[model samples]
Target: MSDGPTHGAKSFRLPISGRLLVISVPYFWLLLFLLLPMLIVLEISFSEARIGIPPYQPILQFVENRYLEIKLNFGNYNYLFTDDIYVSAYFNSVKVAFFSTILCLLIGYPMAYGIARSEPGQRTVLLMMVIMPFWTSFLIRIYAWIGILKENGIFNNLLLAVGLIHQPIAILNTPAAVYIGMVYGYLPFMILPLYTNLEKLDGSLLEAAADLGARPWKTFLEVTLPLSMPGVLAGSLLVFIPACGEYVIPSLLGGPNTYMIGTQIAGEFFLNHDWPVASAVAIALLVILLLPIVWYQRLEARNRGGAG
Candidate 1:
């Protein structure tokens, strides 16, 4: 008697068709947007250069017998590997991304920790301040940095007024400006993830350490830092991936000395009109970036498995 209605209710679920429809919504979206573009780019990467709109020789051509002739061009891929300029740009992108991720971690961690420790009322305000940059257009924010970093701009003018320097120092159109723009643009990404991790930590863990006569610094090093590693990794990846392909910041802030993979890719596509070559370079960038990303994903999967 007790099991009859309850058991029947528990066993009931949405129809299989209904469940399949729900799953297919997001699956279809990913297939249409993400997977489709990747496949198209991968296809283009193997295409030959052609003179015309679209600018790439099709991979398949129909012969007289109705047999498809496949023309695969490895020249674009070969050119990327052979050219020292492309190789240097790849290395330069890695260098910039590495430094930017580090800087974001250093600057963001403390800010995130502070926010995590704050009273609930204050935490909201602090988070708002961190997110305030998003209120304005990202392009505008990047452009504004150009003015601030310029020799005759607000930063130099303020320094001059305070007698900190005899003349305005050159900061605009330099690698330093690129670094500044990256850190400013990507800092919040680092902070939000770190904050999410840190805020959820048990307070009693710290108390227990304090009770055991552990120094505050020692407790942090042992307890807090190790616990925040997941956040650190997530935030670093978030910053590193975008920074690697960042075109606008480097183009606007960096000089001729600061050529990156994005700049190289953009030049190949727009100026050279070599779609195949550009697509190959893009595929190569993804391959280069995959190392750290795949590692992180594997590590995360292992951690989740262990937790389960």
Candidate 2:
């Protein structure tokens, strides 16, 4: 029996100088910024809280002046589960993030479709308008919504003036307000990806579908929608992850009933001064956010394999 061709191969290695230059840059950056901070947070999450500047007890200590003692407290993680507040916060965050993402999709898809189908000259103008809000500060935009959603605000005033309603309806400090702000603020994120994907769609595909006796709506359902799924996923993750951990919008617009992970984490760290629990919450939140990214990568890999 002969050895197969796949059984033997030569592996190439980079030169010492090339390896140093190519790998060192990214490795150095990750070490300094991403890995180091994450490691510090991970270590802190396992330690007990104390009255100190940093608010967490030292994990490593000299035992008997020779042996090192490592203190790892898993109580914080347990507390997150045992406490109903924390559990509810996580659930509410996910719920809000999910519905907000869907709302963005419904509104953004049409806007993106319009922009992508616009004339070349008009498309640039439309895109600029879509991006124009970003030129202003995000904080300022959120504050502006308070004026619109407040009971005595312009929106209510307009409705009153037009005789649409006898009185101002309460809108501020509610879930509806939070959703409105989220959709408004993150609309661009959803639209940009969708437009990018929709723009590159081959026009001939639509024409071919039409020739084959497919109606516009049916063609869109069977052909266009399937092709634009990647953009939908990308845009959804872009909105959902950040919204899951959103602090500013919820703080400004949401009432006491709005329980979210970001607000709970902030409360744990700043108000309660529980550093370990806060770190644990943060780590859990980070893990949650990374899941979609992982899923996207796997899907992309499967797609590439199928394409190949």
* Clash number for each model: 0, 0
TM-score of 1: 0.89
lDDT of 2 by residue, 1-308 (tens): 22345334321266668868888899999898999999988898999999988899979999899989999999999998899998999988999999999999999999999999999999999999989996778899998999999999999999999999999999999899999999988999899989988998999999999999999999999999999998899889888988999999999999988888989989998899998899999998888878886886776676466555
Please give the CA lDDT of all the candidate structures: 0.91, 0.90
- Model 1 global lDDT (CA atoms, 0 to 1): 0.91
Q: Against the true structure, candidate 2 has what lDDT?
A: 0.90
TM-score of each: 0.89, 0.89
**Model 2 residue pairs with clashes:** none
Compose the digit string of candidate 1's lDDT tens values, residues 165-184: 99899998888999999999
